[model samples]
Target: MNSLENFSKWLQEEGRSSGTIKTYLQIESFQKWWVAEKIADRFEPEEVTVLDLQDYKQFLVQHARNKRGGRLAAATVNKLLQVIRTYFKFLIETGVISYNPALKIKNQKIQKSHNTVRWLEDKEKIRLLRKINNPEGMKNTWHYKRNKAMVYTFLMGGLRVSELAGLIIPDLGLAKRRLTVHNGKGGKERDIPINDDLFQALSEWMEIRKESPDEIVFLSQKKGKFTLQGIEHVISKLGEQLGLEDFTPHVLRHTFCHDLIIKGYALQVVAELAGHEDLNTTRIYTMPGERETKKAVNSLSMGDSF
Candidate 1:
């Protein structure tokens, strides 16, 4: 067996996820290609050269074919390079390789365009909320109340879909009007504040929750916990019925941040409220719309408009 096979075995022994192991194996394939085509033999711990590394990178860009039979994209090639770099670092740390040849290869920088944040405008938000609350035909439907509570939690509390789904009776602090979210991303916990609107919605939903106290807060009609896909289907169906575009849970999150920013909340406060670990991650949610940009520019004094 080659070093790649040994590394795969080691990764499995270390309890790495299948996805991670698969990505590492893809990197190992690139290394095998380097040995077969560029170096004329397997790279020993300390015998690989920077020139050989550069040749492998060129092969990734000019010759590598994706599963779709297309040339590898710059982004995909960059990801492969990152995987290779990480593997070499791991090999060095484990004393399997004395020198990290992959480190000598520079990654191709891919420029990112400003992504358009999807959010509901204020009027659209109000309209959607009212529509969900007062569903004309469905007077006593479970979907009506459930969707209303879901939208309320997202807009008012800024809870992610996962956090909302994972909620339990113990997570709610009725007196304080707060929710304790456990095991958020990165295994972090946070208490998010709730307003009267959200409190009322939760109270209404609680009247209908027939499960035990330890059961999940949100449940489907089948009395099972609502999955991410289920929530997505609800949002999409509602969006279509209401003639709205691109309505998803993430769009609701964007609306939460956009509403907060427009109401003059500081970026740091918004970041904390959104449960983001980094302020930079939250900054993406604060992109101003046309009206906001106009207001900002109009407020600036340009010294007699030179």
Candidate 2:
């Protein structure tokens, strides 16, 4: 019926997940911004021009501020541009526009550094695992168990947060000592082995978890499925308690990959386990991180010689 409605249908037919569709539809904000800028009385896809897109890209780079009033990351800007480009493509396919105006715009370059991939150091991992493993004085035993299993799944299994949230009862193949990620990134499916530690943690949670008809692997005390934010909140609270700054699902995932690389696991093996489509993504772990760099520098320290 409407442009957005048609776009939604198109995205669904393209097999994009609901989350991805929602993200792509965030182009409404850009449309509103365009109208507010007095570029046109009303935002229309067919009327948009490449110069308008360039101006908008410049605005995003120079003016866009996140919720915290900080400049948006290059990746965030590029994601927005991607949404715009896709929406324009949709318009062209539907015969609403003659051409995709946003096509030629290039994404901002993202500099990769060793520090970019944040993972837990040995001591930090030990501290976090120790506390979660044997949480002393924690009153809510149910929450502790569920949260511990979540932490272990991230740390040991290398699952993305979305995959963890999407996990169902059938996905946990305890008999085979592995967990199936049925809905991994890009709808790919993979199985991660359930080592003794992860198996024990998951089993402990399963014993006390509330029964839900949805068969969700993890459930809230209210018998509802955990949302992405809900899962992050649980982990965030744990991070606060442990004094681990920026402790997140991705950090745990990085730690898993990094640890595997450090242990001499093949890049292909780590990529498959982590569901990474690219070996280059896995190879970043092979680079010397801050700890290794510090160790090398400290070895030549004048104070150490004295």
RMSD of each: 5.8, 2.9
**Residue-wise lDDT of candidate 2 within 155-204, one digit each (tens)?**
99999989999899899999899899987765678989999999999999
Give the clashing pairs for model 2: none
User: What would the per-residue lDDT of candidate 1 be over residues 37-120, giving only the tens digit for each residue?
Assistant: 655656654666677778778888988899999988777887788777767776887788787878778887655432456778
Q: Which candidate is the best by lDDT?
A: 2
Error of 2 at 223 (Å): 3.6
The CA lDDT of each predicted structure is 0.77, 0.88
